[model samples]
Target chain A: MTETNKTWVLRSRPVGDIKDGDLELVESPLAPLADGEVRARTIYLSLDPTNRIWMSDVDAYLPPVGLGDTMRGGGIGVITESRFDGLQPGDVVNTGLAHWALYNTLPGASLAKLPTLPGVPLTAFTGPLGATGMTAYFGLMDIAKPKAGETVVVSAAAGAVGSMVGQIAKIQGCRVVGIAGSDAKCKWLVETAGLDAAINYKTEDVGAALDKHCPDGIDINFENVGGEIMDAVIARLNDFSRMPLCGLISTYNATDPVPGPYNFANLLMRRTLVKGFIVIDYFPRFPEGIQQMAMWLMEGKLKFETDIVQGFENAPASLSRLFEGKNLGKLVVQVSDEPK
Target chain B: MTETNKTWVLRSRPVGDIKDGDLELVESPLAPLADGEVRARTIYLSLDPTNRIWMSDVDAYLPPVGLGDTMRGGGIGVITESRFDGLQPGDVVNTGLAHWALYNTLPGASLAKLPTLPGVPLTAFTGPLGATGMTAYFGLMDIAKPKAGETVVVSAAAGAVGSMVGQIAKIQGCRVVGIAGSDAKCKWLVETAGLDAAINYKTEDVGAALDKHCPDGIDINFENVGGEIMDAVIARLNDFSRMPLCGLISTYNATDPVPGPYNFANLLMRRTLVKGFIVIDYFPRFPEGIQQMAMWLMEGKLKFETDIVQGFENAPASLSRLFEGKNLGKLVVQVSDEPK
Candidate 1:
C-alpha cells in the first residue's frame, strides 16, 4: 500500500510573528510499523501559544524544534494498525507531543489509550479532558491553592486553560474574575462559565476594571496573558497573593526581548508569590485532574469550547487564532475525521 | 529645662532620587513623657535602600511617610527614661519603625530590649542581628530552603541582607555566589563572608561569570538587586528553583517606571518560585531565626560588616551610599553617642 504522510516541517525559526515559509508542509511516504509500534491517523491537533515558543531558537521548557524537523504539537488520533498488545484498530489514543502530521507512527507504549467518558466528545480530549484541562487544573489547585471567599483573577479568560481556571476557581468557592480580549468573550465568561465578573481588556482599562471588580484586592492571579494585563493585576494583588504563571501569551510573538510586568515592584511590596509552571510537569497527576474535571463536566458545572480549524494544510496559519484572540476557547485543527 | 530634639522631617515626597529639600532637619522642643511612654536617644540610624522607598509616595510595605511628619526609619537607641514596668533608664531597645530623630518618644510596650551578647558589638544589631539580618535569615531559610549541595546566588552580595544571606547559605553547605558592585566588595564576600565565588557586576560580565562559577546552575536566587543582574540569574536558574526577592535597590531611585528582568519568561521555563518578602512579616518567628543565626555567629561560622557614616546631619545624604554601592555591608548613620 502506498500511503503518504503529510507533515509540517520547520523551515526556519520565527523571528517575531510566525511568517510564511518559517514552516513548510512536506509530503513523505509512510513507513511500516515495527513490533511495539502503532500507526494512528490524526483526528485533532492542539494548536497553542507555546507552539510559537517551540519554533523559536530560545531556551524554553522544551528544546526548540530543530530546523527541518517535524513541527512538534499535541494531538488525539485513532489507531489504524498496531503491533503491540492492549491496542487495536479504531481505538482512539493521545499522541503525546507528537508530529503535526496526518499519520503518526509512534511507539505504542508512548501513546495513551483515550478513555471513553459518557457524553464527552472526541474534541474534548484536546480540551477539557486533555492537556489544556490538566494545565488549568494543577496550575490553580496546586499553585494558587484557592480558598473559600478569596478573589481569583485569571487572564486570557476566554482561552482554553483560562476558561477552565475560572470555572475551577468558582467551584472551589472563590470569587472569580476573568480578563479577556473581546466583549463577546467577556460575556461568555460571565454568562456561560459563571465567573463573578469579566473584563474586556481590549476596550476597557484593565486596571480600573480590576479595581472596580476586586474591591478586596486579588488574592490569586492565574496569569496567562502577560504584559499590560499582568501589570494591572500585579498592581492590585492583595498582601501574600499567589500567582500561578501558566503562560505569557502576550509576549510569545514579540520580536525584541520582552520585559516583565511594569509593576514588578508591587510583587515585592505586596509580598506576593509568583510561580511559573507547565502542565506537562503534572503529567503523573493527570488521572487525578481529569477525574475531577470530568466529574464537574458530568455535573454541568464545567463548560468548554473548541475552535476547530479544519485541514492539515492550515496548521501553521491557524496558530494565529491564539495570538490574535480570534479563537473563543481551545484552538485545534481537525487533520482527519473522527471515527464514526 | 528646655531640651530640643532634631528630626529629619518629610517636607515633600521625592520623585526619584531624594533631593535636599525633600526632607529638612527640623528642631522642636521635646515633649514631656506621659505614663507608659519612654524617651530614647538614637544611637544608630539605619540608612537602607528601603528608606528611599519610604521617601517616595508610592504604596509600599508600610505607609509612606506623611508630608511634614518625621521620616520613618529603624534604629537602635538608648532609653533615657521609662515609665513602663520592664524598660528603664540606660536600657537599649529597638525602635521598631521609629522616626529618624535624635530622640524618639515611643510607647514603652512596643520596644524590644537588646540582649547583651558577650563580645558582640551594638553595631552587630544593625548588621547580622537586626531587621536586615532577619531579612536575610527568613528570606533564605523559609523561602529558599537551601539544600547541602545546592548553588545559591545572591545579588547585592556585600550589602546588609546579601552579606548575611551568602553566609547563611554557606553554613547550609551550599556553594554561594555573590554579585556586587565593586572589586573590593567582591573580595570581602569571597574571603571574609566565605562565599564560593563573587561576581563584580560593574567590572565583569555577570552572566559569563555566573556561568563559570555556577556549573550546576542556580537553585536559589536571594534577589536583593533587581535589573540586569536579576535577568542574568533568572536565565540560569535550575528547575524548581526558589527566588526570595528581598530588595530591588537598583531601581529604587529610577525616575521612570522600572521594568522587571528582561529574562522574566525564564522563571516560567525553569519552573522557578519567585517570592517577594519583607522581614517584618517574619517578626513573630524572629526569636527562632535569631537563635540559629546567633549560634552561627558565636561559632565563627558567620561574619558581618557595618559601614558607618557619622553625624545626624548626614543621615539623608548617607542614604546615597546604598544607591551608589559605596557601602560595604550594613550602612548605618551614627546619630548620637553610644552610652559608655
Candidate 2:
C-alpha cells in the first residue's frame, strides 16, 4: 500500500464549461484511520449530473459543495485498513464524497458492504444495481405511477436512471419511448432495453418526434434533461399525466439560469402533475426496490449498460463526458485493478 | 305571465374587451313545460369569470357555448309553471344554462330547490352561499390542505372564493394573507375577514408585500388570479407548498393569450405542488362542505359580501364587472322581484 495518495480538488468555479484547470490534482500523505473509521482504496467512482447541482450554491434537495473541497462523489472501494470492528481488510464497500483519491478514511456508518456476484461486474454495484437503479425504481413506481398500456417517456434514456426508467416502464406493461443524445444510444435503448421507441434528440426534433412516436401523448414522463426537452414534453402531456422529476442534466453546466417557455397553464389545461424527487427520500423502500431490481436482472428481464473509464487519473475527463453527452450509460471510473 | 320572454344571445365573439354589442337582447316566444321539465322565470343570474372560459371554443371542464346560442349561466328562478312532480309553482330553484333571459324551461336534474330563509336576502342563494362557496370549500380543504401555523395567501381576496378561503384558513388556525385589487378590499380582508395581513396588489408590489406579510413564505396559495400575481406567489413558495388552482380571472377577458412568466422550475426547487381543481369532483363531499359553510355563516364565523346589480337587462354589465375587477365578493344580477 502506498503511503501517499493522489486526490482531485475543485480549484475554482467553472465559467461556461468545466475545464482541466478547474480541477487540481494534489498528492498528500495518507492519514491513520481513527477508532470508528476504515481506510479504503478507491476501486470505482460514480460520475453523475447531480455533482453539477452540488457545485452551485443554489438551494436543492442536498447542500452545495463548497469550492476547494474534494469533489463529492460515490465509489466502491476495498478496505485496506480497518479500525472499525464491523469491517475487515479487503472488504469491498460503498461510500460517498470519495474523491479521486487512491486512499481515504471513511466512517463505518458511511460504508456499506458489497456482495460478490458470479457473472455481474463489480461496477454494477456502482451503476444499475446501486443508487441510479434505485432512483429509477422509486421515481417511476412511487412517483410517476405509470399504468399498464400508458405511454412513458424517459429523457436521457440511455444514461443511468433514464435507462432503468425505460426498462422498468416496459416491465410494467407501459409503452416506453427513450430520448438520447446519440443514434447509437437510441438503437441500444430500442434493441437491448426493450423500449417501444427511441428518439435521437440531437438529430431529431424532440417535439415533432414525440408527436409522431406518442400520438396518445405521454402519461408518465421521467424527466432527466430539464431545459428544452422538458418544455416539449410539457406541451404534449396527456390529461392527468405524471412527471417524476429526477434530474435536470441539460442545465447542469449552464453558466446562466435556464429560462423556461413557461407554459404552466398547460398543467391546468391537461390536469398534469409534476413532482420533484430525490432517491434519499425513498430510502425506507430501498430494500424493496433493490430486491425487485435484482430479480429483474437475474431473470434477464433488465439490462444495464455502463461506460467505464480505465483509471483514477481519468476521473475528471470521465465526469466531463456526462455533461458532453458522450457517455452512453452509467459512467464509472475504475480507480484500481481489483478482481470481482 | 307574459306570452313572450326576452333572452340575451351572443351576437359575436368579443374581439378585445367584451362589450354590450357582443350580446343582443332578443324576444322569444315562451315554450310550455314538458315532462320532467319546468317553465321558470329567471330571478337571479350568477355572473362569474368561468362563464368566459365556457364562451371560448377551447376544451375545458365544461363544454364551450355554441355561437349564436343564448349565453349560458347559473341562476335562481321561480317555477311559475311546472310539469315535473319534484317542482312546484313559486318555488325558487338553481339551474344551469339558464340564459340571461326572463323565462326558460329546464330539466329537473339541472335544478336544485333553494331552501327557504325568511328575511335572508334571496340573492345570497345566487352568490357566496351558492357555487362560489362550494368552490372555495373544496379547493382549499380538499386540495391545498393548509395546516395550522402555515401561511395561506389568496389572490382576489375580496372576491367570492377568495374571501371564503381566507376565513376558512383562519378557521383552520392558518395565518392568512389576502391580495386584493383595491385599498378598501384590502381593508375588508383584514378587518372583516380576519386575515393576518392584506395586500392591495393594485397599489403595492405583490411579491414584496408577500415578503413583508409572510416572512416565512406561503404554504398554501389559493390561485384565482393567474397572471403576474401567480408568478409572484410562485417565487415565494416554501418547500412542499400546495397551490389549489380554481380560477384565472386575470386571463378570462384576454382576447389574445396572456403571456405568463411561467416559473415552473421554482416548483422543483421548493418541492411545491400546483393542482387545478373543479368543485364538481368533490360532489360526494358537497353536503359536508355546504353544511359546514352554512353553520359558519349562521354562527357569524363566516361573513359574506355580495355585489348585486338589479334588473335582468343589466346582466351583461354585471358579467363584465368580474373581468374589470369592479365587483366585490360574489357578483349577482337580480332578474326579478323577490317574494314577500
How does each model score on TM-score?
0.97, 0.92
Can you write out model 1's per-residue Cα lDDT over A44-79, one digit (the tens) per residue? 999989899999988899999999899999789999
> Docking quality tier of candidate 1?
high
- Candidate 2 lDDT tens digits, A189-287: 999998999999888999999999999988988888887788788788877888877887777777764655345556666666667677877777877
RMSD of each: 1.7, 2.7
Among these predictions, the greatest lDDT belongs to: 1
Q: After superposition, how far is residue A15 of candidate 2 from its true place, in Å?
A: 3.3
Question: Model 2 over residues B181-279: C-alpha lDDT tens digits?
Answer: 888888889888899999988789988999999999889889999888988998888888888778878877666755544565666667666676776
Chain A TM-score of each model, in the order shown? Answer: 0.98, 0.96
Which residue pairs collide, candidate 1?
A: none
